[model samples]
Target: MEPVARAFAHVANMLFPRGCVGCDRPDAVLCPECHALFNGCLAQTLGTAEMGRWFACGWYRGAVRQAILSWKDHGDEECDRPFSEVLCSLAEQAGLPDHLGNVSREQVLIVPAPSSLASMRQRGRRHMMPLATGLASYLCARTGMHVRACEALENRGTAGRSVETGGTVQRSQRLKGRITTRGKILLKNKAVILVDDIVTSGTTMRRCVDVLSSQGAEVVTVLSLAHTPAGKPTKAGRHFSSEI
Candidate 1:
């Protein structure tokens, strides 16, 4: 019965394509204007990361946030293409191609930031896997390097609660020691590119970096679809406006 329903649902979607994730305009995953929202390369500093920074495609607000929420929580798988394109463009803007060395011999690993098991269960998938896989393929084609997406990180489900709504300290504490590497990954001396959907306060990204660094993995840089806007420009000294 489930398969029958899915088949009919698939046919129905073919006949009546859904609206864009950003604007709800008909028959598109992300209409041109909505896709445009994610066009810029915004870099933010992560004090603990290997490179001392990371990059995001855009700020997490307005249409960009709306589109991401739809795709991530509401299961709009169609947005994968446009979002993947965003990351690829970001890679170019961030000079990742040149940074990837010895194209023929180096096999870089694209690892998605871990999603808690509970979130995976709720979403029925590891949402970031598609973006990571897409980035891997793009890098391979563009640089002629062997890029593979590796799920070497996993969240042991300790953060299935209301972690997202918590304050910085609360969020950081909940995530501490919860992110662990998967079984027997030979990450020593490997080049890893960490990908995440959204980054706020850099807690999770920092932890992932710590784990990867512990294994002697050189994380080239971190990339995200979007990141929460920096706070208090006068104080934090790094507030990025929500604009492009």
Candidate 2:
């Protein structure tokens, strides 16, 4: 059965060559042009009222958006390499905060945002773990930081919500009682970096920081692939437009 399946898969690929994950052009998972277009960072501030400084690679638009959606919705595991490359590039370009800069290899850890069991079941695998692993590997290779993705946070049976409908305050309130930290082993004195795929209103990231900080983890910073920038104010009051 395995051999038969492999043969079928080969035949399918031959019939329709793998295309660029971003633009669907033939020959590569992500072509050079798309990569170049997705390489720059967007203008946004790190919402550090609850946690440390946050950094994201680029805006959630164009090729970047398509690439992320492909991996997340279409199971394009091949997107990991390019995605991880961009992640490392972003990390290097945007240096870690001064507080996190002093932590040694043994003192540092990476904790990715926990995905829900229901979402895991639907996806048939844990997606964030691979991205986390790739990022950890890159970090270790570059900075010699002993990186580990701690399963310190849990979803606590909460349903995922869309970030577009409500405003930031309402979204923060929605996630108020959803997440919780696991284990009594406090990361109090340790340097920690939270990893996630994207950030919109930053409500979710703030919630994670609240949980980790309560557990004594010195949550130094956040690393994400894409971010939606805060919009400009209108004549009436502060306004928002979701361009990314």
Candidate 3:
């Protein structure tokens, strides 16, 4: 059965080659040009927010945005590779916190922002898990440290709301108290990094930090694929208004 499946896939590929996720160029998952574009914007951290220091590969634009959108909305799971490569590079460049680096791989864990159950069901996939798992793999491979992803966070049983609908204030208010951690509190005294696709206003990340801190997890840092550049003087400090 496996051989037959492989054969069919091979034939399908021959008939219709996969295009670059970022640029829609044929015959590659992600073209070199797009990869370089994202690589150029690597940074140690985006900005200091109430949640903690945030890091990102670059602004969510051009190829980066296309890659995320393809993976997140269209189920192009392979898109995670390039995205993770940049993220892992950022992690390496930024370096882990002293305490976290000193700890055994088994001690450090990556907690991804949870997608609402309804969204997960609708997509038939757990989006954050893939990114987190990819990042964990990269961290382990690069640093020889064990990295575990904890599905310890849970949505506060509210419908997943769009970040764009309301103004920053309204969005922040809507997200407040809408997410929580569940089951065993593994974060207690453990080093944890929160992973998300993007960070704009830091409201959601702050809320997550609040929950994790209450659970006693030593929140080391927060990471995102992209942070919206400071827009034209919005009331909310900097708004990650664009999807990176």
Candidate 4:
């Protein structure tokens, strides 16, 4: 931000006195205590062939859940920078540098998981674009490769609540024919890393992977800010399959 913008922001904060998204502590978007929850994040090897591997900053629960909801749905756009920082931190921890050691920047594409056109319009922005771009810059600096953030996948106008907000089976069925790659050769034979704000039933991520694969992109893994917890079996030991 420029000096003028910074000054304006400081004045605004003083007037509004924002609280932490998680704990509502004054003047913090996310406090250290809540932010600490994302450290040492675990990778969940979901049962999706296309997803290969999936990783997240933390499990979506408690403060994390509230924080994500606030940013994703309520137009808390200020959280974008902090969230992008967390994602870059996750990438650093996951040794993405080593993974791209051999591939030129041109051969690597950081792909944002597509949001519906409706959702983008509702939010007034492509929410994941900045985060993906930040991650691409990090990969470029670390690996000395010129990486690009490719908005390759798109969601067709499927009329219904998303899987994250509706029944899993029905949402999965609705998502099946809705995602596809842009008709371009940019992704052909390039290594791609998928980025999303959250992963619930894995439906969205898998659909993205499938479309990218169809476009001949080599999707290596997925990086997300959070994933819904895989809780205990509902009944008769039928676990909630993350790989819908």
Candidate 5:
């Protein structure tokens, strides 16, 4: 049934192409105007020494937020390519690839932050995986580095509650011991860059960093599609904002 629906959607798109996800402009996935919204290259940092820096392509507001929500929550898979490009561009602009060495036996991995089992079941896919793979490919081409996407993280379901709808401290506590490496991750002494669609409170990203660091992986930084501006966390911010 899902496959049939997807096939129908593909056929319909071919016959009557949809408009930009960000602006509803005709004949484009993401029009230049809306794409511009994702070009800000915003950098955020977590105060925790163990938690590495974080970067986002845009503020989680206005058209950028809309586009992200459409892609992430609503299954507008068409935006994946554009979002991947944005993240890769942000990486390049941040001087990430320049700092990387040439291809080595140990790959510099792009690791996607794990979605909760519930979220995965609801979305029917690990949405961040594509972005991670795409970014890895881009880095391989740009830096001649042995980079690849590693689904190294998995969420080990919370107890009788959701991680959402909590204060920053509360969320951090809840996420503790919730994320674990997927398998025998060979991350010892390897470099990693964590990827996610959105980050707020920095709790999720920090927890991810903690798990990777525990495995002797040097996480260079965290990257996301967009983040909320600094201030009180609005409902929107809590929904999809990166943390510093």
Candidate 6:
């Protein structure tokens, strides 16, 4: 932020005193203890995906849940930086640098998972785009790849609530044909790192993978800020999933 903008933000914060998004620690957007919850780089199996694996930064529970909900839906835009940093941390934890070492690509793409038109309007933006850009920037600096963040997918508004809010197989069924490609670029033959704020039933994530694959994009793996815990915790205390 510029000097004047920084001063204004500081003043606004002092007056409002929003505190931490997770635990409400004074002056902290995400307290260190809350941030620690996101460092696991939890892994899950996505059977339909080419990469066959995806990762989440934390489980969608407790303080992690509070932080994500505040940032994603309640307009705690300041959390973007902390959350994005967590994602970069996750990339490093998940051996992304080592994986990219093997792929000789001219460019890599960071693709944000799509939201419905209604959801975007409600949130005033595509919530995950900032994270995608941040991850792409980090990947460029880390891997020396010409990385680009692109809004390559869109979800036509669904009839009922999302799988996350509804958490039903019926809601998952509604996801079919709901998500589709939207950009001028087909994303053909390019590497894609899928980004989302949360992964719930994995229904939406799988549908997105299907859409990207149909367009010939080589999806490296899915990455989300948090996920609804649906499997046994590994011995390391990280979230792990069975075949989805």
TM-score for each candidate, following the candidate numbering: 0.87, 0.80, 0.79, 0.83, 0.87, 0.89
In model 2, which range of ten residues has the least summed lDDT?
233-242
Candidate topping lDDT: 6
Model 4, runs deviating above 4 Å: 1-14, 46-51, 102-106, 159-163, 183-185, 232-244
Model 5 lDDT on a 0 to 1 scale: 0.77
lDDT of 3: 0.67
RMSD of 2: 5.2
The CA lDDT at 88 in model 5 is: 92
For each candidate, what is the lDDT?
0.80, 0.67, 0.67, 0.74, 0.77, 0.80
Residues 4-73 of candidate 2: C-alpha lDDT, one tens digit per residue: 5547756777898989987989999889988775465433344542233466776777777888888875
Q: Write the per-residue lDDT of candidate 4 for residues 106-160, one digit (tens) a residue.
A: 4888899888888877766788888888888888888777788889888885534
Candidate 3: where are CA atoms >4 Å away? 1-14, 40-52, 97-99, 102-106, 141-144, 157-163, 232-244
Off by over 4 Å in 5: 47-52, 102-105, 158-164, 232-244
State which candidate has the highest TM-score. Answer: 6
Task: Provide the clashing-pair count of each candidate structure.
Answer: 0, 1, 3, 1, 6, 0
Location of the lowest summed lDDT over 10 successive residues in candidate 5: 233-242
Report the Cα lDDT for candidate 2: 0.67
Clashing pairs in 3: 60-244, 105-146, 200-240
What tens-digit string does per-residue lDDT give for candidate 1 at 114-133?
A: 99897887777788988999
Model 1: lowest-lDDT 10 consecutive positions: 235-244
The regions of model 1 sitting more than 4 angstroms off are: 1-8, 47-51, 102-106, 159-163, 232-244
- Candidate 3 has its poorest 10 consecutive residues by lDDT at 235-244
Clashing pairs in 2: 188-216
Compare candidates 1 and 2 on lDDT and give the better one: 1
